[model samples]
Target: MTRVDFMQGNIASAEGALAAGCRFFAGYPITPSSEVAEHMARRLPKVGGRFIQMEDEIASMAAVIGGAWTGVRSMTATSGPGFSLMMENIGYAAFTETPCVVVNIQRGGPSTGQPTLAAQGDMLQCRFGSHGDYSTIALAPSSVQEMFDLTVKSFNLADRFRAPAFLMADEIIGHLRERVEFPDTVECTPPRPIREGMLPFEPEEDLVPGFTPFGHGHRVHVTGLTHNEKGYPASTDPDLHERLVMRLIEKVERARHEIADYDIENPDAEVVFISYGVPTRSVRQALLDAPEGLYGHLNLRIVWPFPENLLKKFPNARVFLVPELNMGQMAREIVRHCDQPVISLPRLGGELHTPQYLLDRAEEYR
Candidate 1:
């Protein structure tokens, strides 16, 4: 039977991870995200899973990557400061092609700005925080229910691409309480197993190699340094290094359209509001109260690789209005992909844009 209950967003995310077969969790307690670790501690052991509270975010990230190589689905959760501490390991996970999920329940800050407040300031950080060039998938949820749905999707994406996936949530969604339906079962796509006689890092047509877990007798060597198809470090070979890095990026970039996920309403409207995360709440309300044909909304669930093609969906669009908690991080991407006038509505200090505020902005373009 399906179970329905009123739950907080962080709790729902934990439940979703459990449903998605996450057997290992290594996290450091951080505000707006500690509940995720707390829930996992209480629930993982009951299901015969492992949950460890690491000394800090950096150690937590390393533990999760180690857990993934052991053939278990692993994850970690954090807020802004913790997220920052994990950047080095995040890059390591990307270079090694380790499949894991990192959930960032965003809070205000450059340095511990507001622990108990909501902010979407980390939108860009998740995409480029780690040094070097690589591509990873990121999903943003706007509600308590999506906090569950998207967390499951993050695991699926991680395993599918053999790369780290991020759940970029904010404090508002992390703490929000709402009704969520727990399905009896969730379908999971496990990693493709390495076949005999195949090179460890050799990729198939999709550019994603089959996974060879540790102790699998596959003779695999995992390293963050540039490597050859046989998984041996080849950093000295310039051409080979280029090929390795390019493949890592193209595996996700070429599939951008396939991984793209969003919601489009009033596709023919001249004025449009593009948003994600908590700001999406205000956009929904503005649409509901606007006059017929007044404006449209493009709500994004997946934000990385910036599905540039989605801009064409609004053929009649004269202007695109973007509202975010950051200082126009994603709005700048919109401007790059579109010829239409792009306006950014930025809100900071841990507050959400009111419905009236969005509607007022829409009127300017209309």
Candidate 2:
């Protein structure tokens, strides 16, 4: 097989999922993200994998979780409105500790605001859109290569951590065509199997429980309610509820450092730019034009658990400038973590900030 090819980001993502040993795909076809599903439909069967077009995103998410319990790596792709629909079941996946990947090719939306245009409006949604207090693992890809690399990484993280993982790409990355160099073999980590005698949801030291594949004599009860280690509903017990909720959040948060993927440059510079996903493209261009040691940069690959510790790497930074596609969804997270003044450069519509646009804004403080 050719290891390098020019392909769209969505197709690269599907190839990544296939490369990661994802044998089952279930999703509703939505704009900007539909190509991922389309590609999977054609590719999965050739790989002896299965693909299903569900009634909607909710069912798509449910089917993914169900397929995962059968010991197969499962995934789904959707855009903003569809992403919103999946929130409920996504919570169920989190509460149940199901290892699966969700690709959200973000489009502008409060309610279908922009179907084809790109936006990072759903960054906060992926982290907190689902009902309540569970932490999530989300990866954002800036290029076609990363769309593949991060999709594979997302699956590894999901299996290693035993939680729902997200490939948080936007429409810009999804539809863009670029050269992607595939690895001869990508690293893989299957979900840790259940021990001889352990409850379904009982966690190990890492706060992640081993997975029990459904079928053949091993049976595990799975429920969305606050459950004990046995996977039975225990919503009535406040103590059990607290313990369960805390563990769900803590498993990812506790592993934040281990889960964090980012890049830092010119750590001693006075003016800094922190961004993830597509916005980082602009940051890179801005950096190239600036003088040596003129600006610091922090680009995140794994965003959720947010990686606030990366901020402290730039000690001399007087202002942390953030340019995002939405109205500063992540800027809010930055504000709480850093003492430095954070300037939120939010582009409300689908427009991306240009390199010149960012550099000009920095002149005041730079």
Candidate 3:
């Protein structure tokens, strides 16, 4: 348990994963995110962990799913195009209830438009990338420090919910050089219990089912198809399918307060600024240096779960500015959660949102 200095965001992610007890990694070499794999390759073995560079991102995702079944906390990192290749396997991990982490350092998309550049285009993809009705937890980091902390949180969430947790970052957050303190004694959230002699799909008080490792002598049979409490395939029962889907959704949906991030800089302002990821850094900086009297800034680090309850407290706001890298992926969620009109400032594909651009937008709201 040692802390390092002068680390890139990707390296910090690797260090965080290791600190969270992640012992297995499988990924391809993709830009902005490849450094995560590289760092894990060098360090995983020293800690009695395993690292593999698969032929492609598909195989990489599959490997981690298998690793998780073996009772090892695992992860995989890739960019936009590589992330697409991992969708099918990601769905597999979800249905099987595999506990692992997926890191997507997003870049210009469609089909590798800009490999080396940063883009927040994967916001929607992380939510809808996998098929079927499944709950995926995606965490976005605005700074290098968050890159470390959220990576650890992502692993904990994955283990807790028995679902694949995503660390969705853009190139800026992945490549940014910053000093991040890595805690030697990392405090991680606890996952659902897999007590011996209990059914895997049995819901605890929180509505989340417990997960157990394969070959643990509990007779668990995990499958990508619909399954029952025993983990054996059970697609024939409609009730079983409905129970599984509802439980998966409720597991994360019910814990929004535990999962969501909301910061209120000015609690008494009429106007609020809403944004996530790297753009939030600019928004905060802009508000800090504003010409004395300006609007309040509500920066969100957790995009999913929407924080519906917390949003009900802001009814007096005249306008809410939703600034993101895409054409309002988060704006859609903001509009759904708020009664006021959400002004969307969308920067599509490989572009960064600047403070001046946001300040100009904020002025219009006034």
Candidate 4:
């Protein structure tokens, strides 16, 4: 049995986190993303969870990291400016192998560019924003139901990969109100516990280390500095640092295709549109409004690690059209992955790419 109701996307995200066994939320309110924190505030304590409104995004992110260390699923929600503020701690989470979730309801940006609007400008930033090399899992939702489903998924992915996972929605999807179906009980994947003889940072065969929970009768040192399997700082050893970072990266990258979530339709069509997040709505609408089998679409839900192989699934694709809210941020990724001519359709000003607009653009490429 399940429950169905009209739900706002941000609220659905909060509920999703709760369903995923997320018991800690620390966030500062920001437009377009604040409702997630608000909903968590009203809902968390009732479930015996903790919710805190920190001074700012930086502190919120740090609090999330601290909460995760205490052996709980933790998260924070913010938009562009707040996302930027959390970069340092995000890097810390990556270095220390902390499992947490960060909800970035992206808005138009560069410095509070458009607080009330949406943009996919942070597409690349979420993957490479921090100082050093690292990898993360990021999910882009095109609907309210996905906001709920993917939040749960982010938690599970974070636990599995032992790093931060991102729910990268935007103002459009974050604010959209739609009917959502609630599962009877969502499954939660807890981190693997420390084995009897393994060190804190020592990885299993999968390149991911088992988690050392607090009060497990084991004391483990944690730091962001280059560390050994025992979690002691070893910043001076070049080879150890290289091995550590590479594992941090490969744990996610090596499993990228397995982690990828996308849908393909009309695979035989010559003109393929690759998209994610809200811009994908336009492509779907365009396909629906056109003749059957006239075009193909690859809609990606997991954008990070790029999932370059999905493009090859459409063997007959002669051209791939990419429509993004940013200036072709993701389109550039497609350019490198395939030989087909890729047409980038970029839109600004917080507007959806109308189906007519998409159809008109495809017409020009022919």
Candidate 5:
């Protein structure tokens, strides 16, 4: 039977990780996200799993990578500052194709801007912060229940792509309390092991190499430097490096359509609201107050890779209005894909746009 409870989002996310077979957690406490680590510390031991609170975010990220290579599903949670500290190692994880999950319950920041407040400021950073040309999977959860659902989905995507996956949430949803339904069992996709004769970094048809866990007698070599199929450093060779990097990108990019998760409402309307995360709630409210067929909504659950094809679903769209906690981060991406006029309704300093605010914005375009 499914279990239901009134839970906070961060706790639900931790429970989701546990259900998805996360046996290892290494994290440092940070505001609005600490509850995740707190829950993991309490719950992991009961399940015979391990939890470690590292000295810093850098150490936390490294520990998760080590745990992943040991054949255990690993995860970590943080907010803006900690997420920044993890960038270098995050790049290393991407280059080495380590499978792990990182949850960032975003708070406002250029540098510690608002620790206890809600903000979606990390949306672009999670995609490009690592300083490399590698692709990754990121999920955005709008509600407490989605916090559970998407965190489980993050683990599955991490294992499937052999790349770092992220849960990019915000303080609003992370701290909100709501009833969540827990599944009897969460589905997971175990990493494919390398065949005996195959090289460690060898790509299959999908461009993702089979995982060779440590202590498995596979004699696999892993490194952050550009490597060949045998996993030896080949950084000096131009073509080999290009091939390696391109495969890392294509593995996720080519699969965007298959990975995309979104909802389209009133597709034929001329005025559209493109949104994700907490702002999506405002969009929902606006739709309720508007005429039945007056506005279209594209609520994206998976934000990275941008799901550009979804734009075609609204052929009659004359204007696309995007309201987010950050100042025009995703709006720029939307502008690139559609010729329709894109208006950015940016909010910062930890406040969500009111439903009336969105409706007023849409009214102008109408």
Candidate 6:
């Protein structure tokens, strides 16, 4: 029989990691996200997995990448400042096509603004946080249960695509406690397979070929440079580089349908509520309070590799309102893809959006 327990969102995330076959964890403890690390520290050992507290976030990220290369599913948890420190390694994971989960329980800041406060300010950073043209996969969970479910999905998607998957959360959700039920046996998908004795840079359809671990009898050369089939650094030929980059981009872009998650409520409603992370809870409440056929919503669980199809659903919505704990970052994306009037309801670190606030906005827009 399955059991249900009340747990903080961070703990739920860690439980999800364990369920997803994550056997290795490396991260420094930070506010809100520290509990995730703590849970892993205790739980992983019992499961015969490994857990290590690195000196900093950079090393933590590096260790997880190494663990992934060794054929172990791995993850790390950190907040905003630590996320900044892990940016370079995150890019490294991207270029190497290493599969790992990064849980960012977002706190305020450009640089440690509010360690205990919540913010969705890292939305843009998750997409452009690292310095590169590579594609990123990120998921935002609005509730504690989602924190659990999405963490497992993050690992599955990361292993499936051989890319880093992010669980973008905030302090409120990370620290909040809620009752969650678990299945009898957790199911985790197997990693994608690279061609036999495959060359690292060998291009295949959908842009991504299968993968082989280092020292696995494959002539695999991993680097952050533009390369060809042999994986050797090759940048002089413009055509070769263009083809290489496009393949990487297209792999995610082409698979956008398989990668995005958008829940629509009352498709014919005049007003649409757009939000992610913890702010989405408010949007849900607003939906509950709204009259039938009055309001619609798009709750984006997967932020990166943006759901182009979902946006097309309400391209000309009468009014689209995005509320985030930041200065209109995601709202800009909605505006960019949407051919409609997008309204901004920005908040900074400390304050969180409430159902009442959204109700007021719905009335104002109506």
Cα lDDT tens digits, model 1, 18-40, are: 99999999999999899999999
Candidate models: Cα lDDT each? 0.93, 0.92, 0.83, 0.93, 0.94, 0.86
Give lDDT tens digits, candidate 6, residues 127-163: 8888867788899998898999999999888877878
Model 2 over residues 1-366: C-alpha lDDT tens digits?
548899999999999999999999999989889999999999999999999999999999999999998989999999999999999999988988999999999998889899999999999999999888999999999999999999999999999888899999999999999999998899998988877788889998888888888984667888887888888877899998988899889989988887789999999999999999999999999999988779999999999988888898998999999999989889899999989899999986787999999999888887
Q: Model 3, range 127-206, lDDT digits (tens) per residue?
A: 77788777788888988888999999898888888889889888999999998887777877656557656687777777
Candidate 2 displacement at residue 305 in angstroms:
1.2
TM-score of each predicted structure versus truth: 0.99, 0.98, 0.95, 0.99, 0.99, 0.95
Q: What global local distance difference test value does model 1 have?
A: 0.93
Model 4 pairs in collision: none
lDDT by residue for model 5 over 77-108, one digit each (tens)? 99999999999999999999999999999999
Model 5's alpha-carbon lDDT is 0.94
Q: How far does residue 5 in candidate 1 sit from its true spot (Å)? A: 0.8
Model 4 gets an lDDT of 0.93
* Per-residue lDDT over 1-366 for candidate 4, one digit per residue giving the tens place of the 0 to 100 score: 999989899999999999999999999999989999999999999999999999999999999999999999999999999999999999999999999999999999889899999999898889899999999889999999999999999999999999999999999999999999999999898999888899999999999989997777679999999999999999999999999999999999999889889999999988889999998899999999989998899999999978999999999988999999999998988999999899889998899899999988877765
User: How many clashes show up per model?
Assistant: 0, 0, 1, 0, 0, 2
* lDDT head-to-head 4 vs 6, winner: 4
Q: Which window of ten consecutive residues has the lowest lDDT sum in model 3?
A: 306-315
